[model samples]
Target: MNSINRILIAGSFLLLAACSPKIYGTVQLVDANLQPIQAAQDSPQGSIVNMINTTGSIGQSSHAVTVDVEGKFESEKEKVTPGMYKVEASRIGYATETETVEIKKFTGKKIEFKLKKILEGKRATIKGAASDEDKIINPGEVSIQPPSM
Candidate 1:
């Protein structure tokens, strides 16, 4: 009976630990000049530090961290899995940044993102694709809108 009780307790501990999340890194938010910028610690949803999945999966937003006034952020220690993720940061008047990073299971690791200044009417197209390419993705019939009377 003593052995059985001990085994049960050990199993419970393992189960709880497995359910906990894993933290990727000690992320820090920076600006274009490579200077640390303090993120709003007002609310979790309004935080400047957010992790995005590069694969465009809408369901991968479970892990989020509220950056402190020192611009340092951290995710749940045991709720996140080790994998490739995009550490995104956005601030008013600053260009949004999405940095591709590989999150590891190791602790005390840190990731830094540098945000740029937003340019007016800046082209956001990815490189290597010609502007006048004949190939059309999701092509649809062109509609001519008559001038409103």
Candidate 2:
């Protein structure tokens, strides 16, 4: 009976480790000031990152991992297959960034992404509103203060 139980346990361990690639990596979210976000992995204000498996083989599905407080994320051992994946990062006030990351031979990789903030107070300035043929002179907005003239 003891021998049978030991054999069964060994077989189970082998079956569990037979196949499925294991890939790993770290993710980080930084503002325009190049500062690390405190709650980068939290919701509402924290950035959301997902890895979509675009290989399209058969039964493969996309995988989503939560980044740590220090902006680090790792994929599950068997969930991540060896192929091309689309990494997308999104935040509330920051721009959404999408990038392609490949996992070759189940090797670990490091990916870094920088987010650009949207300016709300800055005025939008349109340059070259006039066509080339209809060149208008003195279109610049210049404020001149004259005391006497």
Measured by TM-score, how close is model 1 to the native structure?
0.45
In candidate 2, list every pair of residues with a backbone clash: none
Q: Determine the backbone clash count of candidate 1.
A: 7
lDDT of each: 0.57, 0.65
Q: What stretches of model 2 exceed 4 Å from their correct place?
A: 1-26, 33-46, 121-149
Residues 1-149, candidate 1, lDDT per residue (tens digit)?
Answer: 69999999999988766555343333344455766555562222234666664543466644567656455666665545556666766666566666676655443335665555444576696766557685566547766699999
- For candidate 2, the per-residue lDDT at 141 reads 68
* TM-score attained by model 2: 0.53
lDDT of candidate 2 at residue 139, scale 0 to 100: 54
lDDT of 2 by residue, 1-149 (tens): 69999999999888766544544444555556866655534322245667788884657768777656555666677777778888877666777778887776636556666665544677898887567678655757656878986
- The top-ranked prediction according to lDDT is 2
Q: What is the TM-score of each candidate against the true structure?
A: 0.45, 0.53
